[model samples]
Target: MSSDLWSFSLSTYAQPGVEPACLQLQSAGINVCLLLCGLWLGERGVAFNEHRLQQLRSVAEPWDAEVVRPLRALRVNWKVVAADDGELNALREQVKALELEAERHLLVRLERTALSWPQGEATDLSAWLNGVAAGAAHLDRDALHQLRVAVTGT
Candidate 1:
């Protein structure tokens, strides 16, 4: 019942690795909240308003070049497939979904770091940048697990 999707990303990925266990748990309706929360957070940022998306795209340009572009290419290719190809399209959607989720998480984290800066700290941006880096590093560990689980279906 926790609203904090960040924490549950790890568990969500874990579920896929143990599919039989998860199916059993699902049947019993136990702790499905983690899965639900991950799904919710995973989808939340995929459709940001145009203005916000623009801002995010701008900020993400440098880091996103390598990661986002390939995912987008995959999504586009997936979209062009004939309607009868459901499985491939579904896989593409999942890949795109996870990429969007990661992007959203990073965007929010970057924004939070930016907002935390005081006017005077503009003179020494390195400290703020370091803090953001550390925070991202911490989040990456859990996010990686969540993403892996999402793709592999543990």
Candidate 2:
């Protein structure tokens, strides 16, 4: 297992079905970065609680709303138009990169927030996943299961 949240996220994302699962969850208004962080916390055996869930959300929601989403919106908006325009395509690619970087930063922030939390106190992975996913509308259970199975093999 990776030692840090960012590395864990990259490793998990590379697993089969994980990318699509994450995308599905994201499309349902779930924050993929937060989901990944919850997975990492579970993998590390960190205890889950409402306060910790809110703490992570506090760090993730704003950055995602203000930074990541805008870049992603621009990139997605340009996708079809950029298909025929090389210049716009290049800019769209840059926006994609920026969106990824923003997510990376959000992961870093989440890791920092969770760093001081004790680990190995809980092994209920579902608790962490559910806690992180709780408030989202139209939560995709299949996607969440795919993510859990892909990462934890459970």
Candidate 3:
């Protein structure tokens, strides 16, 4: 385990298949930062509950919508044009960095919010993943399972 949400996220995301799985989930409207936090909590054996899930969501939603999404939108929007225009490509790279930084900030906020929560009391990783992943109408179960397997080596 990485001992911190940001480090955990970085390492887990670097795992084989995790990036594509996360991208699939992200396209399904999941907040990747929040999902990573849930995975961190689950791996740490923190028990899952609706209240805690909501608390994390509350912390993530606004920052994601207001900060992360816009930067990502700009970066994604510039992708095609950026391939040709050196100036726009440079700007897009900056936007991509900003987007990553925004996600890192969100992870920090999530970790701070979860700092007081107890750990090592739960074993059902699916509970945490599913809870955070709830409400996505078209979620990819295979992609989610890929994340679980990649993280837990199960």
Ranking of all predicted structures according to TM-score, beginning with the best and ending with the worst: 3, 2, 1
Candidate closer to the true structure by lDDT (higher is better), 1 or 2:
2
Q: Residue by residue across 60-135, what tens digits does model 2's lDDT show?
A: 9999999999999999999999999999999999999989999999999999999999999987789988988887
Q: Which of 2 and 3 is ahead in TM-score?
A: 3
CA lDDT of every candidate: 0.43, 0.92, 0.94
Candidate 3 per-residue lDDT over residues 1-154, each given as its tens digit: 9999999999999999999999999999999999999999999999999999999999999999999999999999999999999999999989999999999999999999999999999987899889988898699999999989978999
- Best lDDT among the predictions, by candidate number: 3
Candidate RMSDs in Å, in order, are: 15.4, 0.7, 0.6
For model 1, what is the error of residue 103's alpha carbon versus the real structure, in angstroms, after optimal superposition? Answer: 1.7
* Model 3 regions more than 4 Å off: none
| Deviation (Å) of 144 in candidate 2 | 0.8
For candidate 1, give the lDDT of residue 145.
40
